[model samples]
Target: MHLRKVYTIARHEYTVTVRRPGFIVLTATVPVLGLVVAVLVLVAGRGLLAQVDTLVGAMEKPIGVVDKSGYFSPVLPAFADDFQRYEDETEVYRAVDEGRLQAAIVIPPDYVQTGRVYVYSPQNVFQRVSLEDSHRLRAFLAVHLSRPWVPEEVLVRLSEPLVTLTPVASRQETAGPWASFTQVLVPYMVAILLVISVFASSGYLIQGLAEEKENRLVEIIISSVTPMEWFVGKVVGLGAAGLTQMGIWMLTSLALSGGAMLALVAVSPIPWYRWGLFLLYYALGYALYAVLQAGLGALGTSTRETQQIAGLASVVAFVPFMLSGLVFTVPDAPLVRGLSYFPLTAPTMMIFRLAVFSVPTVDVVVSLTLLVVSIPVAGWIGAKLFRLGILFYGKRPSLAEIWYALRSA
Candidate 1:
């Protein structure tokens, strides 16, 4: 491989792709869109919480009570301003209808024997009572009634404890809810971003190859440089462009939501070592896919056919993403462990495992070893296909022909 020629070709590819309108629009708009989405979600959440608070607060208004049994009248004074005793049910209904009271309570004459009480309110207003409101009301009544018998300390002890216990098997304690959520979400996001970046960048390689072949430019270009050199140049160039795009996205995200992004990273359970491993896997995975895409592109005579082939390959790459939920729940499951060893699925599955669970060191070593070994094998096959097919036009080569080319190249 000629380094100068490869660099020249790579530089040319990078220049062409980076200047494209699509690249500019995508890079610029993604951050803005993310900001908009985040703001909208925040506003919506606050609005919902505020509404719930309002509902609960509204439930605390004075309720008119008609006590024929006369037992609750003595205890009613404890509620003070929140309680209003009425002699008859008509007066209670009148107060509720006129909006002077939120609701009316009726205590039957036999309430001391049978502890049944009835509540009355407009159907529309009554339906707004939330579970929280019910719980608060029950607690208030329980406290007042039990004040005469049960001790306050006993009541406090009987209520559910506010403390939470987190078990730790090793030196590291189990992750909190936010940390767990971050762990799962970040891995899936990284996997999706990796897949998208690979597909998007590799598409440029495929389209460039197919376009060169269609325009009869490959014939002239291949005369000066070896096919392998040309292929390496394209991969390096496009891969750099992909990384640049992702870097821009990361920077933009930080610029737009620095505090939130920092908090998320701070709370995440992923260690620095796992992040380094992720980068390694990302590079290897991109190289593997890039070469394969190049080979497929060389075989196709038109942009449409090349894209269809690339799309199918992208689908295969995304299989690990589809299994991400399973990885989050059971990182050590047999199927998940198996996928982590497969070259196409290894990068994403390994990321998920490292992010959410403690993967055995041996498994990590073996997964990386398999990927490292597979990259070159894939490169060799891709080079063979590219060298043979770059010159051929019109008809796509069959698998048998490809095999023959692989052997003969």
Candidate 2:
């Protein structure tokens, strides 16, 4: 319980972990690989874009338009090459059959009233028309319909709308599509990174625990330091190491992308406060799992066995991800909300919900409270398990015995 003893133990654990060759290699590998990939992309990006443009151009056969209504007489000069006028629907079909046309568009005579356009394209059974093809036909229709009413510049802007959103409060401008996409993407990325880092650091904890127990070193360590001090020290020190790894990976990405990552964060549609919540959830999630791992890890007789036992916690953590499709589609559904409040799944589920839509303030508060409250209870249970299991040898303890021990602790 002494602050000095806890700090000394924590310092020792952190120094030992960060200095390990495995830790150094694992930490550096990602950034080094990212740098190599970034360099290659920068060197060849222009050439790659050019090649893609050429390939697309070569593959895109001109679309045939049958203007039965005679409304689209002189095709717009802008779309002249992309669209070829065909007088006969039969001729258009023939051209399409011969692979000379990518698609055939038939304009009905009642196009003014019904506005029904027939499209013919070859595709597999499950396939739909390509977006580019549909977009081109729609653009052609829109231009002809609206050109007579709106100014030319206005009509052009209708298709290529480069909109920016500026909220009254933040006064930050965000690009339309990119910002929306980032709102959904960033939360998912944070959740995944949080889980990975927590497990990686906790894996170190369990591995060290199992090694010490196996070698009969726990007795010596415990004789010098109280169990609570040892447990708290390991958790704090390893959590710092995990935080350090996550920081390095993020910095590497920012450096590799030439500050593009920073720009994305600035324009992200996620509220500023949600980012803070993400950090809070990450810390609580890591602490809760670390406590669980410390207990379960001590129960195992070997490092591999310890990891296997500790991995059950990871399985529980990943349940939210497995049901992520539902979370994304129905963020406010009963099941998703329940998961969001459940301590084990709360961190990831809440993050997933936040990415998809705005979760209610009450739900956020409740979930955070649950995670905050669960850590101490888990710590007490873990302390009991660690205290008993660290010294006990031979057969693995049964659930009944563990329950009894918990009651006694």
Candidate 3:
């Protein structure tokens, strides 16, 4: 209960945790790995585009054509080395089968009247053909088919339409595809970050508690300070350490990709206020989980058992993330809305809804209120467990004993 005691404990916990090699590795490695992955993806994407260009260029090999329409044969010479005119469809088919041609284009008798042109390849390879090839073919046809009767402007317009239609919206609505995409993506990222921070920090609290209890260190520590002071100090101290880890990762990410994050914010349609709310919800969510983990850690006598309990809690915490796809698609759905009010799932779901849609103010208010209210209640229960079970060694206290402890003064 004393502020001085709490600060001392918190400082001790934070220092010990931050100095650990695991903490340093995790904090530093996540950002580096993220940067590496992003760079690889960028390089791979460029490589893929280059490969496609090469493939399209390679596709300029000779193509056999059966011009049943009689209109294409005269103009086929204009295509030069790219196309070879064949009198018989059988000859074209034979040429394709002999691997002398990459593909054959068949112009039906009704080609001038009907715009249908059939392209045949030996192995249905064109089914997986790229858009560049299709565009090239269209350009070739458009040039050859243009006549004195049809204006060049008309031909060009027909080949490539310049008209683009975009929906008009007020300043409040997300205006473009990029904005809408970021609206969904940012919330999902924040949700994942929240889960990671909670798990990382709370797991530390659990392990520390289990280890201290195992070593009989809590008995001596408790002798100097009340159990309540020790419990609060450990939670506050460990929570700060967890926050420090999160801060490092965030700073590293920003340092590595500040431009990308800035670009996202520039294009995003969601207001900045929503992000502020996200931070508040994240804190509440962390406190709730941290306290619950602390209580569960108190119940266990070993690191392994505490971890199992923490794992179960983690699974429960991740339910919202599992359902995030559904949340993205239908943020206002009855089931999603219901889960948004649930203390375990609320943090992620609320953020998701706020990002994707114009969530009702009442909904946000109610969810926030519930999460905030649950934190202290969870802390009280966890504190009772910590007080009762901190001294118990080897065997874990039963549910009945935990309940009895809570019921006791």
Could you tell which candidate, 2 or 3, scores higher by TM-score? Answer: 3
Write down the worst ten-residue block by lDDT for model 3. Answer: 123-132
lDDT of 2: 0.80
Q: Give the clash count for each candidate.
A: 0, 0, 0
**Cα error, candidate 1, residue 181 (Å):** 1.6
User: Residue 292 deviation, candidate 1, in Å?
Assistant: 1.9
Runs in model 2 with CA error above 4 Å?
Answer: 43-46, 53-73, 76-134, 137-175
Q: Give candidate 1's error at residue 68 in angstroms.
A: 8.6
lDDT digits (tens) for residues 304-372 of candidate 3: 888887667767778888888888788788889889898888888888888878899988989998898
- Give the per-residue lDDT digits (tens) of candidate 2, residues 74-144: 78766787889998988999998887887788889999999888877664322234634567667778887
Q: Worst lDDT window (10 residues) for model 2?
A: 123-132
Predicted model with the maximum lDDT? 2
Query: How well does candidate 1 match the true structure in TM-score terms?
Result: 0.79
Ranking by TM-score: 1, 3, 2
- Model 3 residue pairs with clashes: none
